[model samples]
Target: MKVSTHTCPVCGFDQLKEAPRSKSGSASFEICPACGFQFGVSDDDDGLTYDEWREDWITRGMEWSSRGIKTPRGWKPEALLKSVLKKKK
Candidate 1:
């Protein structure tokens, strides 16, 4: 698969301007619009593993997470999730 820098490592939403983690291993602190995973806050502060969050998000019905941002037309989370990097972290 062609990995993208803009892709969300957990949820495969590919619209981000930057990767979740930087080369220096700093979390971007950006919250994903698709799955609501805050790169730093969710992972570091909350102690929530990426895979655990993804699994729970999937179990709870994949819904658009961003409140201010409108969901894209024809949003299909399961389909987009196919591009997400699996539980490697």
Candidate 2:
């Protein structure tokens, strides 16, 4: 059987690791070590390019954070939005 390699769509990193399987034996996700991007079901079938992923990721992240979900690195939604906007400027 031929082995298939997975790459991070966001950072183009080939070093991807599989995440732990869910209890329900559902779909699995791959995590990119280089950029810490987790590729899930939506990402696989969303037909989003890297640029679109970046934009959508940030937007969804902010939306989740706004709902009181703790974001990575202790960043608030507003703070993360500011940082991204600053980089675009």
lDDT of 2 at 11: 42
Pairs of colliding residues, candidate 1: none
lDDT of 2 at 57: 59
Give the per-residue lDDT of model 1 (tens digit) for 10-39: 788888867899999999999999999999
Q: Model 1 segments beyond 4 Å from truth?
A: 1-5, 85-89
Model 1 gets an lDDT of 0.86
How does each model score on TM-score?
Answer: 0.86, 0.31
Q: Please provide, for model 2 over 1-89, each residue's C-alpha lDDT reduced to its tens digit, 9 standing for 90 to 100.
A: 95555544454443334432345645356544433444554455565444675566555552331223233454344543454445555
lDDT of 2: 0.45
